[model samples]
Target: MASLKGLGYSGGMDIAQLKAFPLFAELPDAALSHIARGATPLAFPRGALICRKGEFIQGFYCVLEGVVKLAFLSPEGHEKIVDLVHGGSSFGEALMFLDRPCPLYAQALTRCQLIHVRKEAILPALDRYSSLARQMLAGLSRRLHQLVLDLESYCMQPAAQRIIGYLLREAETHEGQTREVTFPVSKALIASRLNVTPETLSRTLSCLSEQGLLKVEGKRILIHDVERLRDLGPR
Candidate 1:
């Protein structure tokens, strides 16, 4: 278990950092400053539980650094990773408005710095900034689409194809024939996210390696044939 640090409503919250998020990018300086005033900075070390299933929602959380795993526990006590929220991303925006308990757990995959934007602050900001509301809706819609894709993959696609699709999507930011991807969280967590057992994930990677598609070294994966891997991905 990792120790937690709470910086309660830091008065020096950065307006520029808030601007970097698409949700607040278009807001005027005054609006951004208003949000900054109510934002609380929280630090969680690796393995810290940020939020738990059924916990009352406090506010929206924006990841400033490191990664957080959004997950839920299975009936058999297994932790199933639903999504990995990385730096520059925000979570719980929709829930903040709904006034309900969180449906999933959020845990720090590594040491993390996060901003908790209080619902009180956000509600008034929304009323003042129409663009912010649109961006929030757009963000929620995108999240829904991703969930639908995940459901489709789980129902209709093979495990190997799902893995290939994940790798290809990760490589999209880079331009090259070969790319290296370091799993931000443990391979087991990724396996859970992809709805596969750890052993199954290993076997699939081994199969891909034997086919000269990619090479795996622990958490680091090196794609040797990007085109072939892409071809194997979901259509």
Candidate 2:
């Protein structure tokens, strides 16, 4: 809800919990301190835009808390959800690395805290810290893998399979079989991520529910059969 200066994160979030992030986990104490010196923390309430399309992105950002929705807007005023980024996940790297403006808008889906390191500051830190370099490389590799998967989904998968696959992947990666993984965002936003119309998504979910594959109770989704859902992946 407040800006970085308002949150009192004049230094980076250099805590043990930060180590849980594979990207920042291996840095030496000195490097971590250097990073901490320049980093700042900010908070956003749900539905607030952290960054917008065509804005000049200055650095890399990691979620210290809550979830963010990365999305794109069409010239005709259509919103397409691209990714749901949660805590420990990072974004804005593409713009930072390429020295270009942001291509998508990042909005907070829940009240959130975030830490950021400017590109200028990080370059010197990375030069002195091989571990940091390795971490960056690992992050890039992971991002590439995700991109490949997304491209595959867009190019080859049918809408039914894509929607089901999205839910199953979210369940595995983010939900982990909790009583019911809260559907963190609206179905319309989710339909955009899966490249389907909201009506189509509703119909697909109804079909799945009718078949005993899943139960949609308001915003919560109970996955009755994860493997059956997984099998919805592309052939």
Candidate 3:
């Protein structure tokens, strides 16, 4: 598939594209224009390392297309995915604002196009536009809340419960008695994200299948009954 920048973001991302992001959505055109001018547009192939841990982030970035994962890597090469950031989402804002080294590294899961908006440009804009500061705070708050929830789930939930909870969360849009959940990345990558071994994930899926709760076909799972699956775990 063709990448996003290849579709229309040629040369560099324009103010209109910058304005489409939630952080910039409320800013005036002039402020958006300034920020866009300073932002760097870049593309990456799958498996590209966008940034490394311990490196200082000079700016925040937003993915225009494709998927990326922010993860921590061990010296022995094991990985733990902290977040699966998809198109239209942003990262690095808090790290940049805090002037600290990144705790996690970002890598592309597919061909990706992103814009890096510099602190130099954003600081002035934030000073000029009070709403921008509020939006930044709101975004960071959401991330922190999610992290807390994740910690709770990791500490309290069992492996099957975590995997089932993930399915229900992903199947939120599907209506009626039946629902479907699709894995955005490979099951191995997902296993890492959920803090489970691939073998355990396969075993759990088989267990669920044997119970007639769902049918797994490749990366897509057809949920037989949403309520049954939901009732299997937490209330």
Number of the predicted model whose lDDT against the real structure is largest: 1
lDDT of each: 0.82, 0.74, 0.80
Query: Which lDDT tens digits does candidate 2 get at residues 74-154?
Result: 688766677788999888776767878888888888988887767876788778878878878877788788666555444
Off by over 4 Å in 2: 1-20, 157-235
Q: 1-235, model 1: which lDDT tens digit per residue?
A: 2334444544578899888887888999998888988888888878888887887767899998899999887798866677889988899988887888999989999988889998988999998889989988888998998787556434534877878888887777556544888788999999999998888889878877876778999898999988666645785
The alpha-carbon lDDT assigned to residue 20 of candidate 1 equals 81
Pairs that collide in candidate 1 are none
Stretch of 10 with least lDDT, candidate 1 = 1-10
Better of 1 and 2 by TM-score: 1
Query: In what order do the candidates fall by lDDT, top score first?
Result: 1, 3, 2
Better of 1 and 3 by lDDT: 1
Model 1 gets an lDDT of: 0.82
